[model samples]
Target chain A: MNIKAVVGRNVRRYRELKGISQEELAFDADLHRTYVSGVERGVRNPTVLIVGKLANALGVAPCKLLEYKETS
Target chain B: MNIKAVVGRNVRRYRELKGISQEELAFDADLHRTYVSGVERGVRNPTVLIVGKLANALGVAPCKLLEYKETS
Candidate 1:
C-alpha cells in the first residue's frame, strides 16, 4: 500500500475511535478543515510537522499514524 | 524533543547500525547528500514521502524513524 494511504487510513481509524469529526480534528490541530479532509483522503503529502500536529490532536504517537499491515 | 530531531536521531542510529555513511544512504534513498545531512541535523521538515524513502534506504519501518522516548 502507498505510505500516504497508510497514514490516511490510520488517521481515519483513530479519529473514528475518538468519535470526532474531521472538522473537530482540524480545529484541534489548528489546520483548515479541508486540509484535514485532504490528509484523511491521502491526497495531501503533509510534512512531518503537520503530521505531528494531527497526532497531537488525535492523542496518538506520530508513528502510529504511519503503521499499516502490508498485503503483499 | 522536536519531531524532526527524533527522526534525525533514529535515521543516524539506523544508518550507523547498517554501517553506511550519509552519502551511501542519500544515494540509496535517491536524495542529495546535503539534504540527507540537513535531515540528520533536524534542519529539514521532510514530508512523509521523504521519510518513506529514507526508511526504505535504511531498511526499517518508516514509523521507526519517528519513535522516541519522551523526556519531559
Candidate 2:
C-alpha cells in the first residue's frame, strides 16, 4: 500500500477505536474538520506537527500513525 | 522539545549512526539534499510521504522519526 493509504487506514482505525467522530477529533487536535476527513481518506498529506497534534488528541504516540507501515 | 526538533534530531542521529552523508541519504530517498538538510535542521515540516521515503532510505520504520517524542 501507499504511504498515504497506510496513514489514512491507521488514523481511521485508531480514531474509531477511540469512539470519537472526525469532528470531535479535529476539535481536539485544533484542526479543521474537513482536514481531518481529508486525512482519513488519504487525500491530505499532513505535516509532522499536524500528526503530532492528532496523536496528542488521540492519546497515542505520534508514531502510532506510522505503525501501518509494518502491517501493510 | 517541539515536534520538528524531535524529528530533526532523530533523523540526524540515525543518519550519523548509519555513517551516511545527508547528500547520500537524500539521493537514496530521491529527495533534494537541501530539503534533507532543512529537515535535519528542523526547518522543514515534511509530509508523511516524505517521512516514509526518508525512513525507507534510512532502512528503519518511519516511526523512528517520531520516537523522539518519548525521549524528549
Candidate 3:
C-alpha cells in the first residue's frame, strides 16, 4: 500500500482506539480539522514535521504513525 | 528534538549504514538530490508519502524512520 494510505489508516485506527475525536486531535496537533480529515482520507500528505506534531498530539512516537501491521 | 531533526538524523544514519549516497537514495525515492540533501540536513520536512518512499528506498519500514533511540 502507498504511504499515504498506511499513514491514514494507522492514524484513524489509533485515533479511534484512543477514543479521541478528529477535532480534538487536530487541536492537539495544531492543525485544521479539515486538514486532519483530509489526511485520514489519504488525500493530503503530511511532512515529517507534521508527523511529529501529530504523534505528539496522539501521545505516541512519530514512528508509531508509520507502523503498518499486517492482519492474518 | 523536533521531528525534522529526528527524521534528518535517521535518514542520514540509515543511508550511511547502507553505504548509499544521498543522490542514489533520491533516485530510488524519486526525489531530487538536493531534496535528499536538504532532508538529511534537517532543513526540509517531508510528507508522510515522501517518508514512505524514502523508507522503501532504504529498505526499511516507515516506522523505522520515526524511531528515536534515546542514548543512555
Candidate 4:
C-alpha cells in the first residue's frame, strides 16, 4: 500500500479510537476541518509539524501516524 | 528536544551513516538540496510524503525519520 494511504488509515483509525468527530479533532489540533477530512481521505500530504499537532490531539506518538502494515 | 530537531538529527545521522552528503541524499531522494539543508537545520517542516521519499533514499522504514531519543 502507498505511504499516504497508510498514514490516512492510521489517522482515521486513531481518530475513531479517540471517539472524536473530524471537526472535533481539527479543533483540538488547531487545524481546519477540511484539512482533517483531506487527510483521512488520503488526499492531503501532511507535514511533520502538522502530524505532530494531530498526534498531540489524538494522544499518540507522532510516529504512530506513519505506521505501515503491509497487506499481501 | 523539539520534534523538528529530533527529525533533523535523525536525518543527518542516517545520511552520514549511509556515507552520503546532504546533496547526494537530496539527489537520491529527488528533493532540493536547500530543502534537505533546512530539514537538517530543523527549520523545515517536511510532509509525510517527503519523509517517505527521504526514507526510501536512505533505505529505512519511514518511521525511522521520526524516532525520538530523550537526552537528560
Candidate 5:
C-alpha cells in the first residue's frame, strides 16, 4: 500500500476514534479544515511539523499516527 | 522528552546514517530545505502525509521513523 494511503487511513481512523470532526481537528491544530480533509483523503502530503500538530490535537504521540499493522 | 524533539533527533540521526543532507532529503521528499530543517530542529510538527514523504525519501517504513526506544 502507498504510505500516504496508510497515513490517511490511520488519521481517519484516529479521528473517528476520538469523535472529532476534521474541522475540529484542524482548528485545534491551527490548520485549515480543507487541508485536514485533503490529508484525510490522501490527496495532500503533510509535513513533519503538521504531523506533530495533528498528533497533539489528537492527544497521541506522533509515532502513534504512523502505526499501521501489516496485513497478510 | 518532547515528542517533537525526539522526532527531530531521530530524523537527524537517520539522515546521518543514510549519508544524506537535509537538502538532499528535502529534494527527494519534495519539500523545502528550510521546512526539513525546521522539522529536524523540532521547531515544526509534521503531518502524517509528510511523514510518508520523508519515509519514502529515506527508504524506510513510515513507522520506522516513529521508533524512539524509551530511554530509561
Candidate 6:
C-alpha cells in the first residue's frame, strides 16, 4: 500500500479504537474537520507536524500513525 | 524531545549506521544535500512523503524514522 494509505488506515484505526468521531478528533488535534476527513481518506499528505498533532490527539506515539499493520 | 528533532536524530542515526554521507543519502532519496542537512539539524519540517523517501533510502520502515528512542 501507499504511504498515504498507511497513515490514513492507522489514523482511522486508532480513532475508531478510541471511540471518537472525526469532529472530536479534529477538535482535539486543533485541525479542521474536513482536513481530518481528508487525512483519514488518504487524500491528504499531512506534514510531520500535522501527524504529531493527530498522534497527540489520539494519545499514541507519532510513529504509530505511520505504522503499516497487516489487517487480516 | 521535539518531533522534528526526533525525526532528525533518527535520520542521522540511520544514515550513519548505513555508513552513507548526507550527499549519498540525498542522491538516493532524491533530495538536496542542504535539505538533508537541515533535516538532520532539526531545522526542517519535512512532509511524511519525504520521511518515507528517507526511510526508503535507509532501508527501514517509515515509522522507524518517527520513533522516539531513549538516548541514554
Strongest candidate by lDDT: 6
Task: Report the Cα lDDT for candidate 3.
Answer: 0.87
Better of 2 and 5 by TM-score: 2
Candidate 4 lDDT by residue in tens digits, A12-50: 999999999999999999999999999989999998998
Task: Output the better candidate (3/6) by TM-score.
Answer: 6
- Candidate 1 residue-wise lDDT at A28: 98
lDDT digits (tens) for residues B1-72 of candidate 5: 666677777778888889999999999999999999988888877766677788788887777776667872
User: Model 1: which residue pairs collide?
Assistant: none
Best by DockQ: 6
RMSD of 5: 3.9
The CA lDDT of each predicted structure is: 0.92, 0.89, 0.87, 0.89, 0.80, 0.94
Highest TM-score, which number?
6
Listed for every candidate in order, the interface RMSD values in angstroms are: 0.5, 0.8, 0.9, 0.9, 2.9, 0.6
Predictions' DockQ, in order: 0.90, 0.88, 0.90, 0.81, 0.49, 0.92
Candidate 1 wrongly placed segments (more than 4 Å): B70-72
For model 3, the stretches where C-alpha displacement exceeds 4 angstroms are none
Give one digit per residue, the lDDT tens place, for model 3 in A1-72.
Answer: 777877888788888988999999999999999999988888888888888888888888889888888880
Candidate 3 chain A: worst 10 consecutive residues by lDDT?
Answer: A63-72
Better of 1 and 6 by lDDT: 6
Give lDDT: candidate 4, residue A48: 90
Report the candidate with higher lDDT, 3 versus 6.
Answer: 6
Judge the docking of candidate 1 as incorrect, acceptable, medium or high.
high
**Which model, 3 or 5, shows the larger lDDT?**
3
Worst 10 residues of 3 chain B by lDDT: B63-72
Q: Proportion of native contacts found in each model?
A: 0.87, 0.92, 1.00, 0.74, 0.69, 0.92
Deviation in angstroms for A12 in model 1? 0.5
After TM-score superposition, the amount by which residue B36's alpha carbon in candidate 6 deviates from its true location, in angstroms, is 0.6
List model 1 lDDT by residue over B1-72, tens digit each.
889988888899899999999999999999999999999999999999999999999999999988877652
**Candidate 6 lDDT over residue span B6-41, tens digit each:** 999999999999999999999999999999999999
lDDT of 4: 0.89
Worst 10 residues of 5 chain B by lDDT: B63-72
